[model samples]
Structures are given as C-alpha cells and as structure tokens.
Target: MTLRTSAVQESWGPTAVWSCAHAQGEHVKFFVLGSVGVSHGGPVLTGGPPQQQATLAVLVLRAGHVVPLHELTAAVWGESAPGSAVMILRTYVWRLRKLLEGGEPGKTGAQILESANDGYRLAVPRGSVDAVRAEELAAKATRAHAAGELEVCAEALAEAGSLWRGEPLAGVPGPFAESQRSRLAELRLHLLEERLGVDLLRGRHERAVPELTALIREEPLRERPYGLLMRALFAAGRQGDALAVFGRAREVLADELGLDPGPDLRLLHARILSGDPALLPAAASPAPGRGGGLPAPLPAAPSGSAPTSPAAHGAATAGGPARGGAPAGLDGFPAASAG
Candidate 1:
C-alpha cells in the first residue's frame, strides 16, 4: 500500500491530512528518539525479542540511510556473531518490517523498510523522527540567536528541549546506542548553553539564575555554566553572590582539573570586584554594515548607574578578535574582559 494524502474542505480553507496510502498505514507509527519501539497509532508495540529491538535501534539511529549487514551484525552481536548471523539478521529485519509496516515478510514496500543493494534503509518523512526534529529546531534557534531575535530564539530552544522524554535510546542496548546516547546528551547540553546565552543577552537574569545554578550544580567542572551563573547573579544585583560563585567555581576547577579558571572567568571577577558598569542589561546595538568591522566596545557606564550587562556590551564586539591582545577564546563566549 502507498501512503496517501486526503484533502478536506474547511470553513477557512482546504486542509489535508495524510491517510494510509497503504491499507495498513493508519495503524502504524515508528519511533526511536527516546526508545526503540513501534506504535500502531496507539500504544507502543511489544513482544518482539530484545535482539530484534537492538537491530531496530541501530536502524533507527541511522534512519533514512543504508546500514550494511555486517555493520548491523557487529552492532547487535558486538564481537561474537555466530555463523548463522546473516540469516538471523534477516529474521530480525523481517520481524521489524512486520511491526513497522504491518505487512507479511517480502510484501512490505520499499517505501518503509527497503532492502538496498548492500544494506537496509528505513524511509520516513523528515521530522517524523523526534531526534531529527530537535536538531532542526536547534538550528533554527541558532539562527534566531545570531540575528538577535531573542524571543524567537527562546521559543525554538524551548520546543527543541521538550522533545526529550527521557534518556535517548533508553533501554536499547548496543554499541551504536551506547555511543549515540552520550553524543545526543552532549548536543542537548550545548543547546542549553546556547539558550542560556540568549537569555543573558535578553536581560532575563532573574529567570536564568535558577537554571544556571542547577546546571552548575550538576556539572561543576564545566566552565561555561559557571560563567553564566556569575553573570546572572551580577545582573540581578547580587554582586557579592556573583563573586562567591566565582570563588566556588575556581575551587571546583582547581580541585578537579588541577587548573585555574580561564582568562574569561578571571576578567569577569575583576569587573565584579570594581563594579564595572557594563554588567547591566540593555538593548543590543544594530548589526554592523555589510563587510564592516565589528562595532566599537560600549563606553563604560556612569558611576552609580546600572551598567549594560557584559553579554550585551560584548556580544557584538566578541565576534571579532579580542582588542588590545586579549586571548582569542574570550571573543565569542560571554565573559567580561578588560575594558
């Protein structure tokens, strides 16, 4: 059966919903983001053996592409495949097709799970897979953030963050799943950092404080989150608390990594100590003209007045090389540098 689209007339206009082009399409849905499983348009399908599920996990991780038989066997069996591994692999594929397509063996079309020249391919629509959709949203968030559209950036990031139900590939065991679990988790953390950066730029310091605090507690050794927490505290008029946070972060880094806090952190500490007027939140400056160099650094705020937040003042300037021979790493990532 082929996948079919149906047009329905509505009061506003005509709308379309995809119907089972295949007789059984209405009953089948496949998923692999949080776990490897199938749903017949309702509850998750079960009763398939673990090995079959592992095979399916590998396929889903590499969805919309070809996964060779040998690679599949290694992922499922690791280093201990039996002589009948190929036949057994074929069996698992057949079982998955049965679950995913609701069709008999050898009858499922190339539209869903197809036997390619050298491997198997699962053909599904873009964004049908949750992980792919999350990545797409993250890309959108990155673009919005770059354009200084903080509201759009936050909304896209929130939607992307919502896609994770739990540990990705949870309960699905294999080399492929194991590796991908860590990779996806790291990507999620990066997205979170990006979101926090946008929040700081948008003057959401009070809102960012709790989230950055929790992130620092969870990952004390990571430098970026601590930087964010410090910035948030300072922006919220908690200068003492911000300095204390730097002290604690310094302790964590020195204790764990046997290294001092980086230049960015040191510069931020100096600014907080002298109460630099650049730490207050303000509207971002307009983008530089085409081929024009970065905007000049914001002038220091008047004494006793709210200073522009370091993120806002430096965000545009940070895109260019550090002025006056500052470290290269301090340019892009937010951290107060010498003024």
Candidate 2:
C-alpha cells in the first residue's frame, strides 16, 4: 500500500495525518503530531511502547537527524544504563518499526529508523513532529502580534499552548530532555504573556485577573505577569489590591534578583500613588493634551544615498539610516536611553 496527497501539506491534524500516510510508499512518512501515526497508507498503525515512544521522542525532538546511540541511551537510562544498552535500543527501534508498519504481531515493520555509523536518524521531512508544529504556531503568533493582528494572535498562541500532551520527553531522563523542557516551558510562558498583553490592551482586564494570578503563582520571578495582574486589579476598581500586587512584586524581585523592578513597574507604582487617571483606560490622560511627551524628532536621513551607518545614528532613530554611512551590520542597533 502507498500514501500520497497534498493534504499532508495543509494545517496538521487527523486529516493531514491521513493524507500524509495514504500517499504512495514513495511519499510515506512518520508523523508524531498530537499522537503517533504511520503515514505509509493513510495512518495505519498507531501507538508505541513506553521505551519505544521515548526513543522516538528523542529522535523526533532532534528532528530527522542522527542521534548518537550513547546519547540516546543516556537520555533514557541516565548514568545507570544497562550494559546491553545498544541491544535494548535496537529492540526498541524494532518495536517502533513494527508499530509504524501496521504489520501483524510477529510480522516485520517498515524501515523508518535508519542506522548510521554512530547513531540513528528519524528520516522524516520537516513539519512532521507535533512539537515542531507547536513551535511554528508560536512563531507565527509572535509575528501576528508584531503585525497588530491581535485576535488572530490570541488564537495562534492558544494553538501553540495546546501542543503539549504532557511534559516533553516525559519518562525520558537526560540533560537534553531537561533543556528541551525548560526552553519549551519558557516559550509557553512568553506566549501566555503575549496573549494576556493583547487582552489587557483591549481593556479585558477583568477577564485576565484569574489567569494572571495563576501565572504569577507559577512564575513568581517573572515581572510581566505581575504587571498584568496589577493592571487587571486597577481596572477592576480594586486599587488597594493592585498596590499590594506591586508591593509583592517589589519584594519578590529584591529577594530573588537583588534588584528593583524595571521602568514599567516603577512607572506603575507612581501612577498608583499619584492616582494617574490614565492608569484606567476609561479615564483621559492627566496631562493638558491627549498626546504624551513626544521625544525629539528623528535626525534626517543620511544624505548622498550611500547607506548611512546604523551604528552612527542615535538610539532614537535606530531604524533610520546610519549617521556616518559605514557598512551596516548586525551591530547597527541604536543605543537605548537611560530612564
């Protein structure tokens, strides 16, 4: 049997799994989206043993690349690995192949895990792993925020948040899995913050408080969630609660980082103390006019059209052309002003 179709190219889901597996054997591929499914002929065999799943997790996380046998064994067994680690790994691989091929209990499975001189390769194309898809959704959500597509941004963030079945590489123990877990967790936090930021901007503060409170509980050291909590409290007409939240944040920062809160937090504290009406979106700015104090006008573009040096330009106009027309490189970021 063979699986072939363009549906595999669309947004990943059960349908995409079916399409990818149903194509021809020529298009056969392994996909580990929300669940494991073999795509040789429309998602035939699904599921795998714990050890086999762990082995595939390491490879899929590595994503179509050779993972050294030693490294793979270490990830699964840590320092007390068995003497027959290679044999055991081979057995796991054999089982995974059988699961993928949909063969009878005793029949041979498809050839998915390819052996290399020192390791094994997953050998699937890009976008086959659900984790990869989750990361892609996160990146797209970030871009949507940058582009000011707030509603779409929230949906994308939610989609990214939904990718995890549990702790990544769960049951797998090693430095690699630990690092991946930490990185993915941090990204999840950032996406959550982005979603909350959009909701706060839209004056949906009341709806954000519960979520923000839970987030702050999980990440006490992160000031962004505290800031959102404060905003939500202030908007909800609980000024005292908002002030208490600020105090808590200040104490946590001092205890954890031995430093004071950043500019945003300091500004918020002053606003609360002085009763800055602008703190509440429904109120108008306290200043004479609606416009906040505008910074100095940006310098004129470098004349002579030779491409201004990004480094030569002042911090305010980092996006503008270089001041001295030097070769622009990554180091061309404008200097930031001190508060």
Candidate 3:
C-alpha cells in the first residue's frame, strides 16, 4: 500500500510464497518467489562506472518487458559500438546482476534478466521504479481531468509532475526510450496546461500569472498555454499585457510552424479583441476537491465486447506482414478495428 513497501504473494507448483518489501528508512529490498522466497536487500546497487549504471538503470526503468538487445546496445555505445556488442552486453548484464542480487553472478541475476524471443526482459514489479509510478499518476491525472473533476485533476497532475526528478531515464538514450521520453514530456505539458486551466477557472489568475509566464517560455508554440497566459493577464487587470501575449503567440506560431492559430485559440483571440467575457466558460471556476487522486474505474469492455491483451496482439504479429514493412513508430499505437 505504501509506495515504499509492497506485499507480494506468488503461487508456484504446489507452494504459495509470500514476501513483504520492507524498507528501513532509505534502504530498499526486492522480494521474489520462484524456487523459494528470495530477498534482495542491502544496497540493490552501488556506485560504479557510469555506463554500467546507466545500462542497469535503463533496464530497471523498463522492467516487466523486453528491451530490444540492439536498442540497449545503441543506448550504451552510440555509434562506436564494437563488433563484439552482444558479448559486451552479456558482460555488463553479468556484472550488474552480481551487484543487484548480492550473490553469485550466474544464478540470481540470470533469473532477473530473462531471455525473451526478441531480446531481454527484467521482471521487476510495477511501482518498483519511480518511472512506473509517475506514468501511473499521469494516467490517473488525465482520467480525472476528463471526468470534470478539476480540483482533483490539478492535485493529481501536480503529484505526477512532482515525481520527475529530472529528464526521464536520465543519462540513458535509445530509440525506444527517446520516443517514450518525448511522449512523456508532451504529456507533462498537457497536464500542466490542464492544471493552469483549473487554477484560472477558480479565479486564481493572479497566482497563476507567474507560472503561466514561465510555461509560455518553455512551450512558446503551444497555443493553450498562451491562451491561459492571456486569461491570467486579463484577470489580473493588465489588459494590454494580456493582448501582447496573444500577439507574441501569433507571431511565434506563424514563424515556426508555418500555420495559422487553431480554432480554439483564434476564438480566444477574438474574444480578447472585442472585450467579450462571455467566451470564457462559467465552469472555469474550480470546484473544491471532489477527491484528490486517480479517477474512477474506466467503462469496462462496453457491454459484450471482448478485450485483447498485448500478448494476444503480439501473437497476431506472426500472421501479419514482416516487421520492417510497416512504418516506424506505429507499433505502439492501437490499430483501427476493421469491424
């Protein structure tokens, strides 16, 4: 229940193994059950060569799924990877396992770094990594926002944002992680925009101005942020300053993306021009905390609809075209159902 410690029970063969992740202050333990209940305590990792740590961190960050071996190699070596890349990767995994398990190299570590058909997978529990927790919080925040729980949305958004200690998978780079990090950054900005919208709706415009101003600097091309900035400025009784923000956003968007403002933004600009306050929705006012966390359960399998798992989709891949035949970056997105 507490983020620091989790209770895990596993049924194996004819035996059930239960282990508790007990944390003593800053100390951490990873418990597992297979042949027997094993506890990995006393510094899951220690300081070492930067590259080795980066490699292990990347794997840990993406635990519970395979990371393409080629992707992990590229992440560590960039373009200068030697011809014995696979051998070197094996060595790194060997060393990292020794460090993590605090036991003989081949046995404890081999179980963790599982050999999948495509590459390798680190089978750690969810919430074991901060990255997983942050992703979950962001998903929850997104759901709360969509459900019209503005105050709860803001709190969850802030909690999700607070989880990022720095750049995601910091000091690690690979095509998959790069794409994932970009998506997370975009999600963060969207969440921030929603949070600011909630604050502005609550007439906390004065308090929101500085944050919105800083956000505009970071996301100059994002129209929603600019709109919020304008609203904040206007509400703070600085009409001229607010209009100036809109003008700057217009110039930046035209110069950069070579496109006109979107409909929502153009409408906001027009309202600002005509001094028509009716364009602002009355629902902008922040409702006091309906709750402070993730949203309720999403609608389940709409009536009699059958749900598909990722493993099933991966199995379906065998009947589909070869992997490289499709466009890149489309694998993760769900396909449109023909039916």
> For all candidates, what are the clash counts?
10, 13, 1
Q: Where's the lowest-lDDT run of ten residues in candidate 2?
A: 330-339
TM-score ranking, best first: 1, 2, 3
User: How many backbone overlaps does candidate 1 show?
Assistant: 10
lDDT of 2 by residue, 1-339 (tens): 222333433224423332224212334444443344444444324446555666766776675567889988977677888899899999888777656553222223444566777988765543555556556665665566556576776776676665554454454444444555555444455556656766765578899999999988877876667767886788678889999998998898888878777666677777776665666654333344655432222123222212121112122212111122232111111111110
Model 3, 248-338: lDDT tens digits are: 8778877887767665556666767776544233443223474232222222211111112111111111111112222211111111121
Whole-model Cα lDDT of every candidate shown, in order:
0.60, 0.56, 0.51
What are the RMSD figures for all models against the true structure? Answer: 11.5, 11.1, 12.0
Residue-wise C-alpha lDDT for candidate 1, range 1-339, written one tens digit per residue = 232433422100122222234333344444554655665444556527777877877766566678889988888787888899899989888877767764222345445788987789876543344556566666676566556566897877776666565666677766656666655655566556667866776778899999988887776766777777787888788999999998998888777768788777788789778776566564332335633334334232112111121111111112111122332211135422211
Clashing pairs in 3: 201-284
Residue 199 displacement in candidate 2 (angstroms)? 1.5
lDDT for model 2, on a 0 to 1 scale?
0.56
* Top model number, lDDT: 1
